[model samples]
Target chain A: MISRRNWIRYSGAGVAASFIPTSHASQGRVVVIGGGFAGASVARELRRLNNALSVSLIEANAIYTACPLSNMVVGGHRKISQQQFSYAALSADGVNVIHQPAVDVDPERHLVTLRDGNTLNYEKLILAPGIDLDWQALQGYDKTAAELLPHAWKAGPQTTLLRDQLRSMREGGLVVMSVPKSPYRCPPGPYERASLIAGYLKQNNPRAKVLILDSKDSFSKKPLFLSAWQSLYGDIIEWQGESDGATVTAVNAENRTVSTDFETVQADVANIIPPQKAGKIAHLAGVTDRSGWCPIEPVTFSSTLQPDVHVIGDAAIANAMPKSAFAANAQAKLCAVQVTRLLNGESPVHGKLINTCYSLVAPDYGISVAGVYQPGEKIWTEIDGAGGVSPADASRETRAVEAAYAQRWFDNLTTQVFA
Target chain B: MIRTINRRNWLAGAGTLATLTVQPRLLAAVSEPVQSVLKRDFPTAEIQPGRVNIELPALAENGNSVRMKISVDSPMTPTDYVSFIQIIAQANPLPDVARFDLSHANGLAEVETRIRVSAEQDIVVVAGLSDGSLWSGSAHIVVTVAACLDALY
Candidate 1:
């Protein structure tokens, strides 16, 4: 997905609306459900492979808002507008970007049913519908709490709401962040949220502490985060890991406080990241595992439970990989190559995969981890010592260069996926 | 004007239909046969057992990327070595799963890796013993959230 900053400010809303309601649509068909990273990537990729391939991307929202860098938007670094991007890029690339929600997928008929009552048929269907919030997993913390404490996982307005909440808070007002345990959409997301909040906290409200209540005892990039937190915020930020029994099991909307299994914490603002699952369509299509994700072959990415269906990105089970946009991009590219092979009647060749997830520790401070894996014993096995966290003592100049590279990385990825 | 199936699509499609036509091939492979590649490589008779086993997480929170380990219950003796092992997810999109080739030179008939289990399903590990015996083991897991769904969500 594109970052919220570029998407919001950089994109012109009415940009693609002209060519969107097309004068004509061609015959061949390639249906892409989600317009996010993987969906957009696959859609653009298939077209690039064969311009004649009928490509249509169905996004739930007309304006494609991004989730990447949404933490910055929430931290008040910049407005959400700066993070936004228009679907016009997809259009320019000859992708039929449909602004509609996809409701059903009938593999038997090779058809996708849209909420608008339109049925799209395709020879090759790519479903990159991203993720959906599993509100049922947490009681009393439904969409209502999301309004009070937005997940901002999907970006857009929720991100703006989070920023507004942060901006309007009185000095010394508490900020509580709720982080899911594991296997969520973004592994380092909550930690990044905390870091960015601490960034905001350090600048704006020194007396106002930012409390991070996590569902896990530890988190991604722990060493770097703790060190930075200590160096930057010192006593300003208080982190309560899961071991402290601070997992929020319930939320009291009236009281504006969250109740964990152990203790109750009240804050001026809260960010509750609910459990996540595949898009509702995957479950409806009966391709999702009991864990609410799709299982696929390690080599080809074809669905394990279903014939003729393939799952990619965050929706598929790619081992030893974190749920980050970069990993999703890697999975999508790998799947794209696999799809090309499968379409050509050749089986996908097994090969080593490389994944590098770069997270911004601070504006000028960046850290990353890289991994390489190959199919072994019917699954992906990480090559020993092939990947690890960025060194703890990395210099400020290096971090600054890495941060700049991070921006360029997002640019390059979006261009690769959509442009 | 051009309505021809690409040779590979035709092969994949025809191979799929041919399996339905050849009931005996499916049944034969089920009990005593092997994957076409394996069968082609080792056209010998039955497998004589040494031993093979798979180790994996008893439970995983995110089934998308679950770790798995497979080991042959064997002492890589020249006289008796586990030649190959296949790990298959009985319920994944592709049932063929992953295939591994081993020899005495490797010293160990063991492998460890991470697997994405779509749902709570049985992971089946089949081993080809040095003597040409095929032994199998399966594990049933309860996956709270499968891997693929996380991506598409």
Candidate 2:
């Protein structure tokens, strides 16, 4: 799509640079909204692609924590400190990172307004704000339920809170996790959480059970996780897909009972992962469709309704890919490439992408699934047989091998997105 | 090109002057054959007659990722055991989602995991019966996001 090199090349040729601020056309200001995987990656990559191109990233949260391995943090395999990362890495790459949310995107004026009331004009704008939870969907739950039974979808404090609650659970306690319907972030995530908890239950509290009260009958990486669970935990885990009447309707946090339309479930801990939509910014910008997601052109990540604005990550509706860390990172790379090319006046072409998601079944064990994607007639198509789940009935030694590879994969992904 | 020419010539022979064209490249893009294996090598299934069971949620909230349990009522015995259990999501990016190799020593014929559902489609699980006969079952799900292998533009 838009590549940075294309911008410099084209700006120096047939066309002038876009989105200039007043007569000060000499400044190369690039403002990026959001600090998650997509935003952080683009901001860092843009600066690295061109040191002379100024870049500023605005994120509401000071720490750009990852949701990728937060399940392990919650499972108590590793401390939350393991999940904590700093923006110093990004800053070292010459990016001007700002800890604030974008309140407005005035494409017509070529400016972005932040929560702090400062307007930053930009020559290029990148929007990577993550998804927002539909807190109002459940009947008995509201913003109040989230305070008690946190979704922990976004990493950092929410993830830490869930971890603390899990650590405090009784030896024979039940953990009730509700998986919201589609279009949410990290499809295979909740299952990994259950697997990790069950892995812990296998060792510390053999009598304890993890009950997954799912909204759907299945999940991502089902075979690998199930194979791992059966081998590792035995009956330590109980799952209710749909035939078990698994639909989450409400939550009574004070009593720790999650209510579905059919019945109410009482548990020691509850993690209510609700359905989601595009970030509120998209809604406010009048960019969301009836599905509560943002639809964009399959070619460039640009908005179909708005100009000079691109939404990536969980916030954007990339319909073919699973909402996982790999997809977001992949989208960021393609978006960056497209942004650079678009700025230079060359049309972008289609290219296949690869994504692999690694989930921890235990500290020393792991599983992964991968995909190889190419353009279909209208959308991207993951080449059949190009990917599948990690082998089932894996030896513990093989699991350990997968675990090592998983760690390496995480490090490589984080580096790709930030470094 | 040959077929288009022949058809056009046939039309011309019938006194119909209409030029026809075709794109020959459209014939090569098709899905490959998917195979499911059990245990270490052989793709086998243990049939306990009517004891095979799969537990899934009735109404799935998210089709993107669903939780599932496969339980077969086969006694984990040395002579009589469920050899392998395999699942296939025909609509997912890859059809063969997961397969498990089992032996009599494992004692339980139950497995659970999270699987991706590409759309509102039926998920099939095959328990290769010990007698070369395969017992297959299916479950339908409503996937909201519909697995986006083509998700990115």
Candidate 3:
């Protein structure tokens, strides 16, 4: 499962000072690929625990915009800048934040090749490449179609494009959104987007309608959303599951039409969330299984297919955990601790892992689901009675408070990952 | 320390095991318990968790405004439909967060809203169907700040 990279000599100035710590003088180097929540947290946590251990974080992007709250940006409730974060703070903490995409990993030689032809040697490597959409799976929906339809799943240009399209759309027009099946990132995300879009349409174009055609028979938080749709905006939102002919078979982006087996839907704006797979780097490193996600050792998050390498975040097949930002951060913290232990010649022990995800139905309304998990015979198992969705039938004031908490949670999470 | 090779093959079949199935099933196969309210309300019904999905954060930064959504798998036909849906917080002072009365006219068995949580607790949802059966789903959340007990007044 190792892919060797061509060696390139690095300047001594950056390499010399990184090797000087006394306590971890023997741990060698730890290189983390991808600077998203999982990779960044592992790199920073490793340095925090043992300064002597050489750690390097390689990232393709200079700034990170979170996918958690990107829906709000598309809904115009938030600006993209508000969700954007910098790695300068992590750099200030003595992490060598290399802004380069890792091209290859050499497990036998313990070296990583960067796009700039530079190579980094490591005792261990952590990979967190997030997700890549399976564009081919969605007929007529590719990277080019994404530019027009705009899934807005990732937080950059696609988000802004969706917002712009919604703004310019005529009143009483249609908005068609197609959701992929399970195992995609943010299971409840598509529903939240529909709710927010419905809210926006209600305010600007009272006659407009939102149509959500889902591949699955149901989605997370079904009752709460149904109730909100009934009470918040009646007749403005229509959702169809597989039973109701909502499983999208193909999408005609040129005509802004999405076709299910039985019905063809036309929209002024269509958002087709395609099927997903592990990012390219995961496949390049040969850590992914048939599921298009990496399998890892539960205790250390090290790759099951590859040794001396760990897979975290959305790319890993964490069956017990969803591919959420919070889960990634939690896994990163655990991976950091376990990787450090491995370097120090200690065995990693089991621990409870936590994940909490919030979805905004509107600016003043929010909902969440949470769980506590521990290692099971197969994978991490949810602790009974430890987590569930937010209570239904909450008062307006409660919704407002939850909405406020959603904002705070976003802030808290970004700080933990980047700052 | 679980071994890697064997576990990987086993887990590959798991495919994110936390996912709740949507199709209705026999009650005895369900591992999670039916809320007492549902058990008492539909005495003859077999309550299960599948076909009912609750969307909410696993963690709450504050307890005040936890956004949530609930959806059930149903054809929404007259012969088989969801009659009502109820939301309950296991640890709240008044556990009945809200109850929604639905019918075949609703076209979909789903709802989205926000709720105030007093503390870290599990949220329970139960749906009564036309066939005199009950379906339920629950999710646990950790709330760092209390929303119900805040001294805003």
Task: Give each prediction's root-mean-square deviation over alpha carbons.
Answer: 14.0, 15.8, 13.4
- What is the DockQ score, from 0 to 1, of model 2? 0.06
Model 1 spans with C-alpha error above 4 angstroms: A1-28, B1-153
Please give the distance, in angstroms, between residue A287's alpha carbon in candidate 3 and its true position after superposition: 0.3
Q: With candidate 2 superimposed using the best TM-score fit, by how many Å does residue B95's alpha carbon deviate from the native?
A: 28
Q: By lDDT, who's the top model here?
A: 3
- Per-residue lDDT of candidate 1, residues A264-319 (tens digit): 88879887888788888777767787667776677866777766666777887665
Q: Could you tell me which 10 consecutive residues in candidate 2 chain A have the lowest summed lDDT?
A: A5-14
Tens-place lDDT per residue, model 3, A83-196, is 788888877666777777888877776678777666776779899999999887778999888888999888798888999999999979999999986567887889889988
Worst 10 residues of 3 chain A by lDDT: A1-10
Q: How many residue pairs clash in each candidate?
A: 57, 44, 46
Which candidate, 1 or 3, has the higher lDDT?
A: 3
Q: After TM-score superposition, what is the CA distance of residue A415 in candidate 3 from its true location, in Å? A: 1.7
**Descending-TM-score candidate ranking:** 3, 1, 2
Error of model 1, residue A362, in angstroms: 1.7
* Model 2 misplaced regions, further than 4 Å: A1-20, A24-29, B1-153
lDDT of 3: 0.75
Docking outcome class, model 2:
incorrect
Angstrom error of the Cα, residue A338, model 2: value is: 0.9
